[model samples]
Target: MTGIRIELSRRERAILRAVAAGRGVLVSSCEPALTIDGCWCDHAAVHNLVEAGLIEKERQVPYGLATPAVITRAGEAALAEDPRST
Candidate 1:
């Protein structure tokens, strides 16, 4: 990986960690929902991660449905680069 690094808030970092651990999902709804093991997570943080292209749905799903979230290459890079991850 390159030396490029991305800054992330604590919540965003937690969400990324959860997704990397296979415990996160994105539910498509009137307001998209992010969940970890069926528990709610901060919407703003989830949205921010998605918008930043660090995480994405694992597969396509219809509206009002849920799909597993997967960390993107950028996400992996971010996790690897984050000092807090150590």
Candidate 2:
């Protein structure tokens, strides 16, 4: 299989690492479809991550409900490559 390289900022990397650490499952805001570490994350950052194929938004819940952010295999690979990640 071909390999993919995704360059992410410190925050983006940390977000992906955290999500991956959670076993590829993370609760995100429903309406905004954001929030990485309990706070609202940059919309563009989230979009970039998703576009990079590292992360994906799960089914959308109600307006006040929380949704899930799932880490793709590519996300796991990125986290594995991050030396600062645990």
Give me the displacement of residue 17 in model 2, in angstroms.
Answer: 1.5
Model 1 Cα lDDT, one tens digit per residue, 3-85: 65688888889899999999998987666588999999998898888887898889889998899989999999898889997
Candidate number of the best lDDT: 1
For model 2, how does the per-residue alpha-carbon lDDT over 21-80 read when each residue is reduced to its tens digit?
553333444323456556776777776787787887666555566657778888888877
Off by over 4 Å in 1: 1-4
TM-scores, all candidates, are 0.88, 0.68
- Model 2 misplaced regions, further than 4 Å: 23-32, 60-65, 84-86
C-alpha local distance difference test of each model: 0.87, 0.67
| lDDT, residue 49, model 1 | 88
lDDT of 2: 0.67
| Weakest lDDT window of 10 consecutive positions for candidate 2 | 23-32
